[model samples]
Target: MRVVADWARQESWGVRLEWGLAGARALGPGSACVVVVDVLSFTTSVSVAVERGTRVLPYPWRDGGAAEFAAQRGAVVAVGRRSVSEQQPWSLSPAGLRRAPAAERLVLPSPNGSAISAAVDGVPVIAGCLRNATAVAGWIVRQGWGTVRQPVSVVAAGEHWPGEDLLRPAIEDWVGAGAIVAALARSGAGPLSPEAAAAMAGSVGITDIPTLIADCASGRELADSGFAGDVAVATELDVSAVVPVLTNGAFDDAR
Candidate 1:
């Protein structure tokens, strides 16, 4: 199967473009695998959780329905937010998430990532970030072994939309996506779409990975809000090889 670079560019290929998580969620259930990218940190959080051996339960930021669902499944609920508010000093950590009681949960209300997951319910969802890009790509390739087609959608959780400024988010997500595409190509999965190829090429210009991340809109927002360290940590690739797979609305290691 072919890959769609950004949702916006999917229209010509008869693929629907999902603007935000809401749009993504509208794409009902199927055999497709939705890969969500919140390059700034949320995706990083999922990678971290998987690496630490904690299962991730994703939900829509606006709706808390996933929280109850996770509780029923005996998984922790994690929250994602555009910026950390006073109410949420620490977004759930991988270690803390692992310690959550069976009936307990971590709620994620991040700016971009969590919403991406909420949009595509019932579809096999995977978390993607620069840090875990290679691992996740490897997992996808393995999953596609012997299959005629692998339906995969890479959702770029760009910065808050309609703001018009996209330099940081664009650069961050393009780089992350590029790494994944490279990994997939290396696995003999075939070539990426032209847009994907361009993104991969663009990632090379980011000489200072950490600095680039920190300067991103989301990164700057997080840093200004006291989450600067998180930005740096998020930019690191392959820090953890855990590939988080979303099953029935929760994220678990893809054993």
Candidate 2:
């Protein structure tokens, strides 16, 4: 950590693509921005909500109080994948959120993405995914983050195995993070670490994102859970202009 912390401070626009909370710490307090990529649902859900003119509050999934937290914030809570129905408009299902009526504010609790985003304290956190990767990168550039000075950290919110305390590498979040990395590289926004560079290279061959993601382990798991549509929505590239910026503990459209 001392080595990583030292490395982060050396560059004018240093960026290290890392997973979970460790990534946030590596970038330290001087980071221009922290982009949280949870492509399977969380960041994609943020895109949908922000596009619909709703602010999303990323609440970490705790014991079962997300509903109460939602009530406290005067926002609707998103249910689990299987618990969603027409009446429960807000849910983790990206497809369901797209079709359901939008609430002015949505409180979404997730074990992966939301938790990672919430853990990154004292930094500007923005949700990014395939749907708004380019736009998010563009916004970062426009704001002079990782451009004129300061650094940015792209945090990939990887999936945790069932009943396990460790995270399994997820292809979807990797690819999603790569999408943003590639965009940032093209803009010459900052210096990319080897891991971020490799991620960008991996994304270069993705000619058919939806097809590839459809067969990934997470995709298959979601399909088994009757949420295949969520995968499809997550693969939509550069179609959304909304960049969900988190400030004061809520995500609203950056534009």
Candidate 3:
């Protein structure tokens, strides 16, 4: 299978775009898995929720007007942020979500992550982050979907335009994607693209892991907003075995 890594919409080739509801609409249906990466926190949040055994209903902040739509269907609604802040209602950590009652719905508002989830349509969607990289990759490989025919697209939910200097979010995603690529390679799946190879190679040699990512643009923004802990929480690898699969506008554990 071919792994296409899109840094952003405008920077993507063949089929890729930056984070937006519009970019998500362009996703075509094929034997492909859409791996959405909002590593700074959103994907991290979804991964946590799945790990805790709660069904997540991801909606665009605007469509939150329809939150009742999901609640009626027995799913919890989570809204993220448009900017960084620790005061947000739900924490992006597994322990936090686990502490909440299963019947409770979480409304989240995030700058980038939720918007990307809202935009995608059709195809099997999966949440991506360093914390769940191995589980996700192993699941994909076990599906036995042969390469060259089955395509895997890793979408990076980057910051809004003009605020693109936040390298942490993208770097976190690249590292996660690299880890996935490496896992796929071990299965003798296929060859890695130069970008994927670089991501894998780049994840090495960071003395202070938390500080390395926290210093990135997104990390700094979160830190300044008092959500620095979220960045540190988001960057950890394999914290949970949950693999959240986007099915019909809600997130369910990938069996």
Candidate 4:
């Protein structure tokens, strides 16, 4: 094997906050657990689907043969947020999923969150969003990661820049992650890392979440694209009791 090494490895053994796949890999190996925050709208959709009694299989993307992936598992693949119809019912809209009849499994695809999720295996992963932040954190604690005080990595699945490979950090996801970090510390799961602490502080800095999220870059982008309802649904706080944990590569209600 040819010797090939590059970036310096910065690993975390305590609660840490990281952005995107690089962070996920840095903190994932042998870590206690991971909380993937993808507010618009992978985890949000997961929260919705799991709450409605359906398992979500997060495919890497809608293209790249996602249909084949779903078909192989006998699951229904979700289409674009606005692509919903009587024949094609599932979509990326959290609110719409709430109204749709629950299915056995759904192949939810996304460029950010699902990719992050698919990258991490052998570690307990929970889909975190504004709607279910508290519940997910509380669930992590109840799993003994809190009492024993193991490291919990909060990974933000950020948005990609338009027409570029670079990931753009979305304010909504930062705030959503902040909510989870704060909840974890509040529940005495463990003390937050400096980065995580700052994120939690940021989450607390915003009081008017609905208004703030609506005005954010990602939010406005979604709104401009006619997904305002999705932004609204994702901004709801602590209204969910469902914790979508990945089991055997599929997210299901672990509550």
In model 2, pairs of residues that clash are none
Please give, for residues 1-255, the per-residue lDDT of candidate 2 as tens digits.
245756544354455587865665666466778999999989999999889998899888765888888888898888887787777868888898888898898998998889888787787899999999889998988887764256778888898889887888899989999999999877777688777888888887789888889999999999988889999999988999998999778999878
How should the candidates be ordered by lDDT, best one leading?
A: 4, 2, 1, 3
The TM-scores of all predictions, comma-separated, are: 0.74, 0.93, 0.74, 0.93
lDDT of each: 0.60, 0.84, 0.59, 0.85
Candidate RMSDs in Å, in order, are 5.6, 2.1, 5.7, 2.5
lDDT of 3 by residue, 1-255 (tens): 333444322222222212333334433345366677777777887887676666666655445464576557664444343322344335444334545554344544455666666556667777878788778877876776425466555566665645463423466555555565665566655544445455556654445556767887767877897666678778776776778887766677887
- lDDT tens digits, residue span 29-50, model 4: 6568889999989999999898
The local distance difference test score of model 1 is 0.60
Name the TM-score of candidate 3.
0.74
Candidate 2 C-alpha error for residue 100, in Å: 1.1
Model 2 ranges off by over 4 Å: 1-13
TM-score of the candidate numbered 2? 0.93
Q: Give me the runs in candidate 3 sitting further than 4 Å from their true place.
A: 1-28, 62-68, 71-76, 79-99, 102-111, 162-169, 204-208
Return the lDDT, model 4, position 128: 96
